[model samples]
Target chain A: MRRLAARVAPPTATFLAGTLLAELLIRALGVSPLLLPTPSAVARAAWSYRETLLPALASTTGAVLVGLAASVALGVLAAIALAASRWVERAFYPYAIFFQIVPIVAVAPLLVIWFGYGWRAVVAAAFIVSVFPVIANALAGLRSVDPALLDLFRLYGAGRLARLVKLELPWALPSLFTGLRVAAGLAVIGAIVGEFVGGGGLGVVVLGAMRQQRTDLVFAAILHASGLGLVLFAAVDVIGRIVLRRWHWREEIP
Target chain B: MRGSPIVGLAVLLCLVTAACSRGGPPAGRVALALNWKPEPEFGGLFEAQRTGAFRRQGLDVEITGGPGAPIVQMLAAGQMAYGIAAADEVLVARDRGADIVAVYATYQTNPQGIMVHASRGVNSLDELFAGEGGTLAVEPGLAYVKWLRKRYDLSRFQIVPYGFSIAPFLAEPRMAQQVFVTAEPIAARRQGAEPKVFLIADSGFDPYAAVVITTTQRVRERPDEVSRFVTALREGWRGYLEDPGPTNREMHARNPEMDAETFALGAVAQQPLIEDEFTRAHGLGAMSLERWRVLGEQLQELELLDQEPVAADCFAAF
Candidate 1:
């Protein structure tokens, strides 16, 4: 009971306090529902439109998960290639930076043109926006090996593959997980942007509701989108902890 | 205090009459919000402001542009005195208990339609649906698309998301897309493609566009002001049709992104549609109760509106 109370009380209290304050402030100011709907109205709307919102929420979450998985797989491989030689990094690194710099909204239309719509374009959009962080972080971890350890490996006449697999890859885990965490959030944003151009998901609901002037529904879409991002972030954090502990990665790093 | 009572009373009465003579105490300030940036689509409203027609009616009008801004929502919230939106949008708002009323309509027919390459030999909606199944780019959540799907047995066409640009349509010749009749055809022509246009209104689902709207509270509290604004708007439309050069120039100055050719073409193409037989017979910016009823029933049939709003309640008297 004490453990449950300790874990749950703070968040519940804070959320209740925030909701009460928002309700009171809006009521006092008499703000228009169009400009800003009250908390109770938003909650009611969220419940009323749960049928529509749930499916959209599921679709967005599915897109984000698929895109994030693909990004992690490609990003880690690219990072390994970069770590292998200076020439490889010089040739490919600029393109990664370019992808990051070009706004996702601008490229989304092109994705539709190339991929011909649907979740493939959405997944590709999320992958493009999210892959760079993993590449950068993994490369940094691979290259940050201790000089003394390198000397020991060389003294033992360790092969390139042996040195990489035995030492550097394990050291890269923490940095790779950090990248994954950041990419997880970005993946959801990319999915929403893709949906904005490619259609299907909470983005459609939000845009449609806004156009229709259903502010309450718009608020509901927002809540779902944020909840999706939060869940992705939290899932990445949990997986990182378990993997890092199971492999004794933390102890090996220092 | 020592002045004669008769002289004081005569002076006060003269002052009060003088104030009323200047069009009833310096007409109220009104903000008229447009859905998109300043362009030929809103030529009449822009002309009204530029030509001081609104001022003559004792109104201080502020014409503002909204790039995807919610105009009807703002009006319902009493944030603005007037706004221009599509009739369908007003119906949706009304269904949600918004007290907005459509005062006048600028477009006699909706310009929304599907455009396809002429080479594809898909001349009509039926042909496009029956043909070897290419992608149809449309905005998500468009009520018209839903209506089209339900009205015509079009199960073969694959629905793809549209990005509000003509580049995708240009690159893929066989692909069909939704477009504004006055707008995208010009863009496609610039790209060396003659798009076969199909106006959605011809399908017997015409909705008013560039509809002038205000709240019911305003209609009850200030009916005279609403009437004056609508009258000024009518004159503005006539002036715009006669010689749109000045209004076009002014709009181009405000929204330089619209190229001169496209702006000119839009101004020319829009005039005929804006002044169709109905508008010609009734005068510019004219709307009738019977027309509103027809629109209301169509919307209800489409399920765009949850319930049919009384036509009289939806539009105010001109």
Candidate 2:
């Protein structure tokens, strides 16, 4: 309990201090709520609109989860195929990089045309934005197997399947988790962008508030989105620690 | 050597500042931020700028255009001297504590409407709402949608969110979507789709469109300048209606996404909406308090506004 408290204290203190300072600054500056609502006003708006906001949160969370799962499944499979041979990596790696570089905003409208303006388009957007990191990191981990260990496995007459299951797969776990963490944050962003273009989730809430000139509500919705991203990232981090604890115990030590 | 580099940096900065200020408008210059991209809806503003109507009024005006900008906030925050918005938007902004007042209304009737495929056999909004359900693409939280819900039974339609695209409507014969009467109908026609538009104004929910707005502070502090700007705007609209060829060419040059043909079509389509019997006697860009009051009441009935805003306070007719 003490350890957990110590671990939590710094961020808690910083957040409280920062929020207080912001409240004071906004009051001192006499900033208009339409321009920038104070933190207190944002909290009030959030509480007042919780009935609408909670459902929007659930809808966006569903899209993010489905998109992240699809990316992880496809990304890991593609990485394995690429790791099987140098020729495969040479043929397909550039395409993965292409997905990473293309801006999602430009592609979101096309998704609407294909998926017909609903959750499916949003999931496709989230998947497109987040899959590249997983593939890249997992491939890097698979390729970084210790040469001496590989030689020993070869000397033992282990076939390709045995070598992969025992050596490369375990070696790649940490790097795959790193990629998953990055993809989790990206999935939230992609989902929001999808919602912006295709309409559903918190993006619509933000758009409606903007059209209504409800800046306080806009700020409230943004805070909810950020909270969702943080929750997703923390879930990935916890799962990574648990899975890595057996073989990669030292790194997991607090 | 270090001091010499700093000296060179200072010289560069001075040169940049000189270039920025040189040949620019004078200190008294005012700017108008448009709520949408350059199109026929903003034809009169472009016409005024091209023909030196503003310069003749001794006012140097810089007009900037973009899609879905926060025009009311910019006006309230003093980022721009004037902006273009709908009368409903101005009222919503005032309700949200932005002290903006509409000075001139461009379209006597709102141009927003529902565009249905001609084959859908949907003649009236009632038929569309009451008939067998089909997909209707619209922005969900707009005041007009709420008003429509109160007045009709829209439960039959599968209302999807409209994202300013006509692709979905073109692809699906059974789909209907919201559009500006002056805009998407033209684009859809060019793309070989026969689209029938049902004007929302005909449903008794008309609010003035493309209203020229400014901070109430500006109206109170500089009434004469506001009057002059409105006068120049009226003359510009008159000229545009008389002969839109020159102004349409210039606007097309600025916004090449709109071809000359599209500009011509939009100009012809929006003419009747801009000039009608009311504007014929009251001059161009005229607004009445009764219309503002009715709009406010409608918004209040829809529960979008906390209360009915005072009609006189929402606009200043110079």
Number of the top DockQ candidate? 2
How high is the lDDT of residue B116 in model 2? Answer: 92
Q: How many backbone clashes can be found in candidate 2?
A: 0
lDDT of 1 by residue, A133-159 (tens): 888888898988888999999999999
Candidate 1 lDDT over residue span B93-153, tens digit each: 8887778999988888888899999988877877777687777888766768877887886
Tell me the TM-score of each prediction against the true structure: 0.87, 0.94
**Quality of candidate 1 docking, DockQ:** 0.17
Model 1 interface CAPRI class: incorrect
Model 2, position B290, has a per-residue lDDT of 96
Show where candidate 1 strays beyond 4 Å: A1-5, A20-31, A38-51, A85-95, A247-254, B1-29
- Candidate 2 chain B has its poorest 10 consecutive residues by lDDT at B1-10
Distance (Å) between predicted and true CA of A24, model 1? 5.4
lDDT of candidate 2 over A1-254, digit per residue (tens): 99889989999999999999989887786666676778999999999999989999999999999999999999989999999999999998998898799788777878888887789999998999999999999999999988999999999999999999999988999889989989999999899888877778987787677777777888798899899999999899898888888778434534
Candidate of highest lDDT: 2
